[model samples]
Target: MTFSAFLWMTFGIFGTLAIFSFLYKDNPFYKFAEHLVVGVSAGYFVIILWHNGLTPNLFQRLADGDWYFLFLNSSKPWYLIPAILGAMMWTRFSAQYAWLSRWPMAMYIGIATGIAVPLEMANRINKQLFAMMEPIDFANFFGTQGFDLLDPTSGLSQLIVFVGAMCALIYFYFSKAHEGVFGRVATVGIYTLMIGFGASFGYTVMARISLFINRIQAIEAWRATGFDESNPEYHGGFPAVFWVILLGVVAYAIVEIYQHRNRPPQSEEPSA
Candidate 1:
């Protein structure tokens, strides 16, 4: 492999191993990886926002100097408002004028909430209401003439969903005390909620597992580039670097264990 590609691959391998090393215990490797990720992500997003957001939408629109875009004579003078507000956010660094930052923050929240509320109502509330209101097709209950229990669009699935939603809503009714038939329905509602939560949790776990698998695949791919002198991807120096890093990590772990074993224990202080 090219030297640049090898260097990047080595970094990626080290980062993957460093993250997995957390299973052993919280150590310097994990901390370094974590901090490196956080630092790089922060800087990357800042550059992205500046270039993709501010540069195009604000700076470019107020081009041709136009009194440095401060005299309200630019083609899109309205862009100056957001730019000034963005600049005002920097006032947070100064104790004397820190309160000035609140104006921009409050305006941003107000505008965001105004935009989000209607979209959320339409997507989450209205769409769900419409779905529940639709008639269940019993003819296609078994999924187009076959016994497909997993088909969410089936009549049986729709009925169960309707009943579960109603029962779940009833369970939240504090005006009436739960007893007899009411209590039983509420219990069913709780079970349905548990099932939903469990399914969601399982899906999240599977996503994490998929991510782990991808990382493993990357490591495997890196290792597949064997040290064959005749091969185009051969790199004799990388294997040595990899071994050095591995040995250094092993040595660090051994030292940490030794220190913990020989360290003196602290005595508890007497109560006043």
Candidate 2:
């Protein structure tokens, strides 16, 4: 492997192991990895926001006056309103004029809510209502085409979803006392919610396991085939840096254990 690729792989391996060290205990290595990740992410986000967001949307529009070519002759001064509001948000940093920041904050919230309401209604509410309203014919439920009742894409599944949704909504209804039939339906809704939550948790665990497996595979590959000059498959040699980090952590742990064992015990004063 080239020097650059080898260097990057070394860093990646060290970073991965350092993060995994947290499983043992909270140590400097884990803290270093955590801080590095947070710092890198924050820096990268700032760069992306400036280059892809502000540079194109704010600066470019202001400089070129390209307001969708709607106003060819007139300058696009309307864009300045948002820019001013954004600047006003920084007033919160000042001790004397912190209240001025509330105006921009309120405006931002109002604008965001105004934009999100219709989108949420169309994409979430209306579409979900349409999906739940699918016809539940008993004939179709037992037909040759409906072999799998549990299949999510099947029409029968819609009936199951509609029932679950209705039950869940009933569980949230606090207008009247949940007694008799309503209480039973609400109990069914609780079961449905628990099942949903369990499935979600399982899916999340699987996703994390998949990521861990991928990282382990990469580490194994690196160890099996050191960067060989002749063979592309074995590009880099065993990482000495990883060994150094491992040894350093081991030494630190040993020292901590020794110190803990040998430290003087505290003496209590006589009771008052």
Best model number under lDDT: 1
lDDT per residue as tens, model 1, 1-272: 67678778878999999999899889888999999999999999999999999889888988845675464887678888888999999999999999999999999999999999999999999999999877988888777559776888988888889999988988898799999999999988898899899999999999999999999899877776644466678877868767877798889979989999999986688657
| Clash total of candidate 1 | 1
- Model 1: which residue pairs collide? 1-233
TM-score of 1: 0.87
lDDT of 2 by residue, 1-272 (tens): 55556557767877898899889898788899899999999999999999999988877677755557643433566878778888888998999989989999898899899999999999999988987887776666644465887666565776778889999889999997889999999988888898899999999999999989999998876665554445555543345555765788789989999999999986687657
* Model 2's TM-score against the true structure: 0.81
In candidate 2, stretches whose alpha carbon ends up further than 4 angstroms from where it belongs are: 63-78, 143-146, 153-155, 225-238, 267-272
